[model samples]
Target: MNELNPLDRIRELCEQRKWSYYQLSKASGIPYSTLNTMLNKENMPSLPTLQKLCQGFGISIVEFFEPDRNLQGLTKDQALCLSLFTSLSQEEQQLALAYLKGLSRTL
Candidate 1:
């Protein structure tokens, strides 16, 4: 696997979401100053910090580091749903799944 720069990956994810660093800081529960200093100095984040970032990005650490995989099988709507679901907090995700289960049961 090619070595990827974590900072560049973070920037790419932010660009994909059209998010500012402040937005990321809020989502990741990271302080803006720490994030800014890390990026400005090109310092690598420790594992826990990286985990917070991955959580904020709605992805796993494996997904964050892995090369992009083909997602062509998903329809646009399905992909959108997945993206929205991933962005939710853990509790919200569980609630969403329960709601979907309830809806499915009515069918």
Candidate 2:
């Protein structure tokens, strides 16, 4: 993955959270025009704006600049499993788990 600057990182996190720029602006109470300028101009957000984003996400400002994938969260395997489970139908998941459990009992 390409390295992301602070603005890029924030944009990515917003996407990951399923937030639009407008959503972030509204939730953060930062002016939409200011946010648009910061993002478009690649200028840094004001400390207050940064604070609002960090607070909105329940993370610290320092943590926000860290590698996007390296944020304190699930391991890759855990993330994969989560993704897979979400894709499975409830009955398919139950049957699959039951089959695995049966195999475990026999071993």
Best by TM-score: 1
- Name the regions of candidate 1 deviating beyond 4 angstroms: 70-107
- By lDDT, the best candidate is 1
Candidate 2 clashes: the total is: 0
Error of 1 at 56 (Å): 0.7
Candidate 1 lDDT over residue span 59-102, tens digit each: 88987887344345888888788767755655678899999999
C-alpha lDDT of all candidate models, in order: 0.83, 0.71
Q: In model 1, what lDDT does residue 90 have?
A: 56
Worst 10-residue lDDT window, candidate 1: 63-72
lDDT of 2 at 91: 56
- TM-scores for all candidates: the values are 0.68, 0.57
Count: clashes, candidate 1: 0
